[model samples]
Target: MSGHGVALRVVACGKTFADGTRALAPVTLDVGRGETAVLLGPSGCGKTTLLRIIAGLETPDPGGRVLFGDSDVTGVPIERRNVGMVFQSYALFPNMNVADNIGYGLKVRGVGEAERKARVAALVALTGIEGLERRRIDQLSGGQRQRVALARAVAVQPSVLLLDEPLTALDAALRERLRGELNRLLRTLGITTIYVTHDQAEAMALGDRIVVMREGAIAQIGTPRAVYFAPENRFVAEFVGAANLIEAACNGATLALPGGTLPVADGALHGPATAMIRPEAIKIVPAENASLIGLVDSVSFLGDRQRVLISAAATKVITADVPNAIALAAGDRVGLSVEPAAIRLLPGDTT
Candidate 1:
């Protein structure tokens, strides 16, 4: 909290290995001051590469630049970048206790004992590791280790914070719990944070804006709601959330599907088109009043909702999420209705 977060700019940044392997295409992005931007994609999508470039751990290609506010840090090394990094492994020293680990960075910068102690104590309380000051890194639980790593990273009051899948090592429940806690901590700290994660849920929860990356290139960048509801491309639509890509022929206002006709939000000129609908958007209705009818292929009972897969509604199997109270089973004939606004027309052919 002592250091002010600066706006970060990555200008036409690209990366290529020595063997001529291009890990990332040139990407230009701006992260506003105290903004939390998440670089999200699948494995090998170069999200980590981009983060490393921003951290000054990996240099960008010629003509690419990384800037912190007005300062060009492209040529700066990680040690001189005034940034905090938390890795998937936490990377705490096995020999160091919690207090020592949190105060290590300040000590390295030649801060006196009294100041280090005060800083360490404050961070310990901030990260909720109050009673673990003397606990060794190896003696803590995975969650505790994660908290310690975070405290250590922020203790130096870095201008920027970079986290690379910091919660990937935890159990599912713990990961979910820590995500909320982390979100709160980040907002409280008001640091310019760039987080990298392959998990879309994590990205949605933490990112003020999500940068969706594909094999070395950015597919889309938008707020979680924007990307989830109006994906710019097929990859983003399918990756950010569960989307049902339906292939149908568009005739102005309605799409002619194999099962029946569905209305579109727009009634403009169109031919064959690919449309996307979220599972929760599809509502199950009485077959007599519905235009689309299908036989249920499978029903998965999730705690709060039921994932119902219906066939014959479209060219492909259409999945829907209905309230758990609604009884549904395989082989049952069901009617499906969706609001026209919920259907998004995506670019590209119906293939």
Candidate 2:
């Protein structure tokens, strides 16, 4: 709560190992004051490398500079950077109780007993770990342990908070619950947080902007709504969620699918193109009134909605989510309709 989250800048930053393997290509990005920016991608995508560079745990290649606001901190060490880091593992000290663990950073910095106790108490309350201050690390559950770890990290009020898959170790239900809690906490603390994860849901939930990476380079950077609704590339569309990719030729009016033609918007010139439709975008209507018809390969009831997998809607199979009370089933004939604006045309032909 007392932290000052500054703007972080990475200019021409890149990483390479001693063995001459380039871990990351040169890149530049900015994390604005009090903003949460997520580095999202698969393993070995250089997300962690960039995070370490920002945290001062890993040195960038020459000519790369990491700046905390106006001051260049490229030569600084991790301890001197004033950063709070939380990892997938709850890296709390086993011998220390919760109070001592939370106050360890203050102790290391030689803060007086009175000040350390006050700060620890504030953090303990902030992280909802008040009643467990006297408990040992072994006495807490996975969620509680993570809470303590986060509290310990924030107890020092670091300038930037770096979290690397902090909630991944917990079970599914706990992970989800903690994600919402963490999002609220980060916003409440007003900390400039940089979270790294391969989970799209986590990125969507927490990030003010997501930096999508691939093969040691950045693929795209945008807000959750921008990335989800208007993906820049085919990889982004497919990776973020289930996308119904329809490959067809455009004649400036409509796209010709195997089943039928769907209306198209402008800017999709005469050439080979791919259209991406999200599962929720495609509507299931009566066969005669629909734009295209397909046989329902499978229908799965998912409480509020039903997931219908189309065996053949076009050249590719399409997955659609419709209302649960549609009375649809596998082996049933169904019609699919989609809004023209919802159909996003991707450039080039990877068909």
Candidate 3:
């Protein structure tokens, strides 16, 4: 249940296939000891490529280095790197029982039976698969199999843990349930962990810091709140969460749109600028006193809140989340108000 985690660093790592397709651009990242860093992005992004490089499964381009604590592990094979890996497929042994699968890593390393059994027992209890130790792989449920895979990976007491979409196989409800458990388990083990997933919710929940990648390059890297609230670009803003990308003309003090103008936090910003706003930040107000007004294009009731799409507010349609208590429907005119602080000026045009 406990193991020391080594700090990990990757310096200018890039990857190119034999067919001359570049899978990853140069990426340099550092993961603090015992910290969980999530690499998040859409498919075909360089997140997985970068992970493969760090895990020693794929070699980085010339001059790149992968370091484990103070040791240079750039050239070391995965077996010698002492890193634990859990794949999307779970990869448990069908022929082995739960206990046997958990202990397989130790047995391969020539560990004594007494020590292996002790480690396996600890992991079984840690993963909440106590009575299922003797169960075959096919006999276990999806969640149970996930825990077994996790237990087997950590059984070797690896210096670092690498997980590639570990929960993608589970149902939505089960995925969410196990996500909380995994968060707690990772913190308890204190293992320097790198997780790759396209699910922003998963990244936000598990990562101490998130590295958002796109098209073989890193788009942004920061804490979950920072990434969500202050994205560096339109891509990060839209990908991390629900965002309203507004195109307007800035005249040093306010942003001018077709409906009305909004006060800007920075008066020095002039000319065309792309503004990003979260749906929750927009408040519904009386149209007569409001600066911005738009006609409701659609409304979707979500139990606790309503998602309202409005047009004629900015250069593009905007979405706002309002309390379900507010009665709204299509074709209704509403006013929108946002605090200056809630408006983030993103670089480049929204287009």
The residue pairs in collision within model 2 are: none
lDDT (10s digit) by residue, model 3, range 1-351: 575789999999999999999999999999999999999999999898898998999999998999999999999999899999999999999999999999998999999999999989999999999999889899999999999999999999889999999999999999999999999999999999999999999999999999999999999999999999899999999999999998888998789989898887977788889989999999989899999999999999999999999999988999999999999989988899999989999878433
Q: What is the lDDT of residue 104 in candidate 3?
A: 91
lDDT of 2 by residue, 97-211 (tens): 9999999999999999999999999988888887999999999999999999999998888889999989889999999999999999998998899999999999999999999
Report the C-alpha lDDT of model 1 over 1-351, residue by residue, as the tens digit.
643789999999999999999999999999999999999999999999999999999999999999999999999999999999999999999888889999989988999999899989999888888999998777899999999999999988888999999999999999999999999999999999999999999999999999999999999999999999999888999999899998788988999987888888878849988899999999999888888889999999989899999999899999899999998878999889999999998887412
Over 4 Å off, model 2: 349-351
Task: Give the Cα error of residue 317 in candidate 3, in Å.
Answer: 1.1
RMSD of each: 1.3, 1.4, 1.1
Instruction: Name the lDDT value of residue 319 in candidate 1.
Output: 87
User: Which residue window of length 10 is worst by lDDT in model 3?
Assistant: 342-351
